[model samples]
Target chain A: MNLYLGVDIGSVSSNFILLDQNGRLYRKLYLRTLGNPVKALKDGYASISDGLDKQHGKIRAVGSTGSGRHLAAVLLGADVVKNEITAHAVAASHLFPGAKTIIEIGGQDSKIIILRNNIVHDFAMNTVCAAGTGSFLDQQSARLNIPIQEFGDYAVKSGHPVRIAGRCGVFAESDMIHKQQMGFPVEDIIMGLCEALVRNYLNNVGKGKKIEEPVVFQGGVAANRGLAKAFEKILGLKINVPAHYEVMGAIGAAILAREQMELSHSPTRFRGDNFVLEGNFTSNSHECSGCPNLCEVVCIKRDNEVLAYWGDRCKKWESSIKQPRDRLKVV
Target chain B: MSRVGIPRSLFYYYYYPLWKSFFADLGAEILTSAPSNRHTVERGIELAVDETCFPIKVYLGHVAELCREELDYIFVPRLVSVEARSYICPKFMGLPDMVRALIKETPPLIDITVDLSCDEKCFQKDIIRVGRLFTRQARKIQLAYQHGCEELRLCRSLASQGFTMEEAIKMWEGEPMEAESETDLNIGVLGHGYSLYDERISMNLVKRLRAMNCKVLLPEHLGSEVVEAEAATVPKRVFWTLGRKMLGSALHMSQREDVDGIIYLACFGCGPDSLIGEIIERKVRDNKPFILLTVDEHSGEAGIITRLEAFCDMLRRRRNYRSESKLSPYGASLHSFENTV
Candidate 1:
């Protein structure tokens, strides 16, 4: 059996997944990136190494995704590097072939991907704040001395969900603490926080976009039943959280790699099996004043012809490929 | 050889010969610009402030065209009224102030005031005061004043005879004219028609100006110079109407650094000049003092001259101030309100 590996190294968390050619998700691990994705990948690899059935299957292709996908690709010698939007969309499309809306909420940020006829129509990302994301809940959980894993279970039991401010991360913490001092029940406060976060998401990040049904909510935050319940209550529809909740980016990445491999007539350019064992590589950036816009650009050069390029509003510095689809390679 | 710049619009038709004779008697030069055109109008609109109206905006355009020549000064005469009771817009009285503020860069401004708004005694005093600035010589001043006065009387009679400018010019050209109109130093002389077409209209503007006994020009003389100079003061290349006016006017005023005053002929209740005349007043008042003559049929020739004489004299005093004082080189910031907006 041939195995395909995918890694998604995001700002807050990292995930690794393995898939078989039959399109089965074989192995997956999701862990906090903790500002150091290289180590997070190693930890994920450690989990994979423990779980590998070495005699039966061999790792054939590797893919990377997320903001730190280039770094992951450089470190793991990924055969494919994809953007987070594409990775998330592909994973959703594969599971629910007619997925219309893919809402991925994570620790630091959230993304809303709109799909039509299995192709991306439009998308929005909430990079400006953490008000509607999982980390907001984490901050509230820390202040309440409630382990986040139990916060959701408590919300499921709440009869009277007390209100708390969740407009901004800094302000929400203070407001949550104030409600706790006022002797509101922990479950109600937690549920209120969940509702506030969902409302914040709908208002700012979800501003000016049509929200259609067949919505798939998958990210690290999908595990929080309380937030899922709050989104359902506000949106007035059933929310689908995929079974591979935490590692969808990874699953998406592996799938994209498989797609690219099928198109590549040449031999695979991925390095070797010991690629993940190699020490981490670093990335750097510089300002390009080539035009009036003066776009500051990031250059991630494993050797130098940018393994990945971003931060240009005009996308002038993005990686190129011999084929147009190869470059615009979604998922 | 008082060459006068009859900026095609306002008082040039009436007063070209009055100024021609006055400056001719003084043996001074007058320069004028070419006639206003689409390009000139565009240039004027580009230079003037945004709020100025069409006619004054166009007047600024003509003056701007005139300022491009290497002339002594472009004449923009200021008049209070032809009659005692009626008056032009307040913008005429304040045009120098307006021009100075809007277009910051340029050469010196020559301003002459007409305070007929007060009385006749004050008007004469103001005239003498303006004359004194030009020269300290009482004898030369009196002679110039006499020549200016006689020329005005003669031109008025000729104007009252109702001779068309073309016929009068044909007749004037027929004689072995003692002193001819200035053909050098082209500039556009702009003002109201009653002021420009009737020599009596601009208070004997042409004869007195022509009496300078120097080269003269009119609005029909503009060309590449105005366009180039006007563009120099603008922030960015904008195709605004008033911007062209202010720019053209500034460029024209800068050329007449030596002119004792600039005379502007603005009409009463003329909406366009209200704001544009203000911009012109602000821009040219400081560097180059100008006279604003607002003309109605009710306009007083005496009052217009009183204003014109005072403006001319103010230019003389401005020269003294310029020489004696530690003058700051005209600090015109190239950046206008236009850039960020």
Candidate 2:
């Protein structure tokens, strides 16, 4: 079997997934990004590569998504680099063919995607708020001295879930403290937090959009059954959580890579194990004062040779790397 | 000649030529503030209140830039209204006062009230009041106003015909229209003139779309009468002049079959736009492919480029799918939206 790889590098977490030629997921791994994407991708790739039995498959094509997609594409020689919106929608519609809506709650950001017949109709992402996302829940779990894995179990056991203000993180935190001081049970407070997150996601990300069923919930936050239950109760529908919920972005990217390869009929630009494992790659950034904007441009290098320059407002620096040999070898 | 500086932020692209010709005809030199850059935005961020919109902050930056020019007077006008019964944003109404309060050691401001809400005579009186500072003759002021109007008419025509502000200004100066080749794809860009026209904030969106072989449409391109008619189709009419114009033009473009998609470039934390944007969203619904890009000073170029690429790819895919399947691509497809039924 031939394997396709997908990597999703977000702010809080980096996900890696491997899929066979038949579009079945073989292996998936979710790891904390911890502010270093290059390290996360390298470590995730190594562990996934080790798990692969020699008789099973060889890596064929690679795709990347999420906010740090460009960095991943440059680091891994991605054949297809896409946004998280497309990747998530693709995976959701693929798994639950009738999924009309997808609510993806990640660590730092959340998004709602409405689909029509397996096509993205409308979508909105959280712009300036990170209150109801996975990071917020993680902070509350740490403060409450409860393991994150057991948070949903506590909420599920609650008979009454209180209403916590979910408009902003600051408001939610203060409200949680106030509720705790007022003698609310820990399970009830946990359930309230889950409800607050669902409400925030609905009002902000799902504002004014038609959110029809069959809805599929995925992302790192979807692991919390408490949040899933709250969403199902508020929306009055059965929310489907796919088996590979945490790494859906990676799965979607892998599916896109397979589609692109089949459509173009080209050989995969995987660069093989030697280039990824043994090659010395170093990245550095500098403020380009070419114009008054003073854009901070990041450049990746392979043994002191510039591979690509990005984050440039005016392509002055990016346009300078114009060697065909370097072009194919780099981006 | 006495020098007067104009900040090139809000309404500069729309009325620059008029003001330029008006000032020049009165024998006064006109200096425009530099185009918005990162330094300008940073200065604005440092000076402006946190609650203000991004464009207003950019305007402050422009004003700060203008302060360095050592002009005799800065032309900061109080634009209350352009048409009868319509108001402008409160920021425009209080801009000159804000400048006076915020910036120290400012040159004398040539503040003029151009409110057409009162009557035509009031507009004439306002112009004449500002004109007296330059010349004492009534005939000279009248002639300058007429010349300004003529130049403005030409600029508006050029802009409506798909010329950018820079291109239109160049055309008004007797230069050839440059690199405006036509493409099959058409995209309607809905936003205030300030956000859509500013290359720095918009990240050169019009040029970027044009480079991808798509014709860009703006609200200013449509006639006011047509826009008003389109706006009346909604339940309640928008009161703000620019807000009404943006909403009207978006509604008009949503009905246009040639327009493949609509991209709304909005300012982050814009109060009026946050409300009107929802209306535009409800109107467009699933009828068209709509993408709302909220831009602020901290918006990253790579992220915007990625979204643009994804949106363009989606439009292309929809076009191909429609042509292949010969099904209606507009609104909810027959195979879609039947889940509830």
- Compared with the true structure, what per-residue lDDT tens digits does model 1 show for residues A253-314? 78767665665544555565455555344568887665533445766544434456665544
lDDT of 1 by residue, B230-278 (tens): 6456555423232343346445754664344455555555564554555
Per model, the share of native interface contacts recovered reads 0.00, 0.18
Question: Which candidate has the highest TM-score of all?
Answer: 2
Clashing pairs in 2: none
Residue A112 error, candidate 1, Å: 1.8
Residues A55-111 of candidate 2: C-alpha lDDT, one tens digit per residue: 778888898888888778767778777778778877787787768999999987788
Q: Top model by DockQ, which number?
A: 2
List, residue by residue over B1-341, the lDDT tens digit for candidate 2.
79999998887877888998998999999998777887888888888878888888898889888899879899999988888878878888888898888888789998888788767788899889999889999899999999998999988888878877766877887899865686867899988878888888888888888866688888877888999998888887788888888888888898899999999988888888898887887788567888888888865665566567657756765786777773322211223221110
Instruction: Tell me how each candidate scores on DockQ against the true complex.
Output: 0.01, 0.33
Give the winner by lDDT. Answer: 2
Q: Give lDDT: candidate 2, residue B284.
A: 80
Q: Poorest 10 consecutive residues of model 1 chain A by lDDT?
A: A321-330
